[model samples]
Target: MDVSKDTPQAPATAAVPDDTPPEVSRRLRLITLVATFGGLLFGYDTGVINGALPYMTDDLGLTPVTEGMVTSSLLLGAALGAVTGGRLSDARGRRRTILTLAVLFFVGALGCTLAPTTAVMVVARFVLGLAVGGASVTVPVYLAEVSPAERRGALVTRNELMIVTGQLLAFTSNAIIAQVGGESGGVWRWMLVVATLPAVVLWFGMLVMPESPRWLASQSRFNDALEVLRQVRSRQRAEAELSEVSALAVKDEQEKLGGWQDIRSTPWVRRLMFVGFGIAVVQQITGVNTIMYYGTQILTDAGFAADSALTANIANGVISVLATFVGIWLLGRVKRRPMLMAGQAGTTVALLLIGVFSLVLPSGDGRAYAVLAMTVTFLAFQQGAISPVTWLMLSEIFPMRMRGFGMGVAAVVLWLTNFVIGLVFPSLVSGIGISSTFFLFVVAGVFSLTFVKLYVPETKGRTLESLEAELRARFS
Candidate 1:
């Protein structure tokens, strides 16, 4: 595939069709709801820190470097977790891996809630990061595998919706908790503890959820795969879908398609991996997590009082949820490549404005509100377009046999990029001021936009099996 060459919109290839029974549709919706709780947890855990950090800084006596550590520790753990979780889901089945992650989520959250020392907090957050990273890989892959082709974009991106909703929940709760607790010594603990409830919900929910049908097929358990598929698809559609999935699964196994070795030796697979890595890096380098992990601090630096910033940060969370909703709807109607490029362009412009505003607007309500508005605009483009498309494309681009592993590796790159940004952002703001820091992101954004235009493929509107075949032929 000459990535620089344009990828035209693919004609929508219908999956099994809308002839599914009511019961089957209900089952599928239930599975999506349950599975996406992982995304909710992902959002809450990451976003809670945004509000928690200032309070934590007071209690822990955190230096800027330590604050960075406290925030980035989970991201570092996530980098490891992405690859480890990927392999685990591939070997142990997606449902079981998520079950284990839910347990980790509970334990890690509890640890964070009770931690008495900075060291303990970092380790605890790392543990949470592991679960977050695992969920990031497993949940979407699980959703992608089970969804019918026509509905796959909407279904898979539901996880993104949950992620932002989780963030919104964290922001809302953090504001409430901070307001109620005032300057109380341990208010951050309250913020951290709330995550435990959802972890419990996710565990119990997955206990009833079926394993990924494609995973079963990859394991050569065709009967089991078909049975699982039938829960969410009509019998005839289930049978037809299983035939296509199993054939690819068997071929993938014969070709030994599911490991690093295959990625290294196969020309097309290697090319796909390059694209996957690019996509992952592109998603992170836009500096979205800088806002997510540090939005409160950013607003404060921009001139809002700490209390006001905490409250105002809710707008970021709210817009993220709303934009993700729009992203989900748009995913159904737009081609992935163009949507992604448009998002990149929108966000780049937003970041540039934020930089310019922070630099020239002078300190006060005006600077604060301008920065806030720009952040909101940046997120609208991000959650609505860049994020959903990024995760959806990652879930779709890999081969069936190694879907989890491939996405995991790419996610590793994404988290590492995020980790670096989260770790450095506070210092960057303190060192050169907020304006220069955002200007840096603006430059990165321009590069990201060009990369997406030249390299990313259009992925919407194709069955996973057919998409894989097309990629193989195009790259070959």
Candidate 2:
């Protein structure tokens, strides 16, 4: 339980040295800020439903079954989007795929905003989900490929920070809008429309950003790759890194290592895929999204009125954002596997407490506050540890040639898990009630912790190329 005890020291390549020119550093920061808008959109679209769904349910006359469909259609679409987006980013380019995803974000949000029927809204959310799933896979891979190994964890996790920030924005906006328009008939539409603005920002921001240098190298565009790398890395370091990247790119090409066949035929890759799938599943089964997509409803169910629940849910959003900031800093300091294990343990305990408080406490402010307290504590660990490590490790562990595809396929499992949880969570709460539903998650979390302890590798100190080599050797 002492996370620091027996932890391995970060290697020589663990931190970014103060050798890069300021301009190059600025460029890297700029790219990270722009690229992570995809994460921002992902966060907003998903989190908006927490508050919007209540209003939407009233307006659309949604039964629990239809509500689940509306809420989970995006997740189902995301399952498809993750794989398709991964393949698209690998085939067309990360920047282009994001551009395309941005378009989808805009169109989908608008569709939801103007949706006249339940079917239309579900379809629109499904479209929005495609963009979300695509962004989930592509953005991290792009950031991972562009970042220096030393800064990779921090830079790539900025996307997660953006994601939580977007969620906060959604939570905050939902509260304000509900307060102002609580009497209005179609207030949820306002909440849905706010997402389109960020989609615009993501599109324009990515237009000026550079493509992933590693992607360029994969296509044998070594000179183009070097130029892009030079924008973020020092002149000499960029050249040296380009050589390492290109050599791997060529080796992967010659070995024909980037397709479904490669994953099946190659023993090491097959093992790597197993680990990747486990990592993806572990992240979703934590029951984080249950809180995310239904925190307001849960609060209302506990004791708060509709308006108060909307406001209180912002606390969850705030905690998530703050925890993610802590998580980003921690990734720089600790090993990934231990951090993840710590998060899993923290969340499981919090969930158990929530179930207990719900079962034992009477229906009033005490039970509500206790449940809220546990949810906040849960977010602190979930965002700060489980999420950042999951995405960063996924972005880090895959082979360079198929980083997009591998992460994408893994994300399919992730989104599908999310989809099932989102869909059935309502029914579970309606059927088994929240306490037993969360107790179920507690059981799942124990399994998740065991998986991380057994299968997840430490990925903090090594470059992507070096890590891939290490994995290839260890698995082989």
Predicted structure with the largest TM-score when compared to the true one: 1
Candidate 2 per-residue lDDT over residues 1-476, each given as its tens digit: 11222333333332434379999899999999989999999999999999999889988999999999999999999999999999999999999999999999999999999999999999999999999999999999999999998889999999999999999999999989988887699999999999999899999999999989999999999999999988988877887788788888998999888889999999989988899999999999989999999999999999988888989999999999999999999998988888999999999999999999999999999999999999999999999999999999999988988999999999999999999999999999999899999999999999999888887777877878878887787778
What global local distance difference test value does model 2 have? 0.92
Model 1 spans > 4 angstroms off? 4-18
Q: By summed lDDT, which 10 consecutive residues of candidate 2 come out lowest? A: 1-10
Q: So what's the TM-score on candidate 1?
A: 0.98
lDDT digits (tens) for residues 1-476 of candidate 1: 34755445443335445588999999999999999999999999999999999999989899999999999999999988999999999999999999999999999999999999999999999999999999999999999999989899999999999999999999999999998999989999999999999999999999999999999999999999999989988888888888888888988999999898899899998989889999998899889999999899889988999999999999999999999999999988888888999999999999999999988998999999999999999999999999999999999999998899999999999999999999999888889988899899989988888888877877767778888987887787
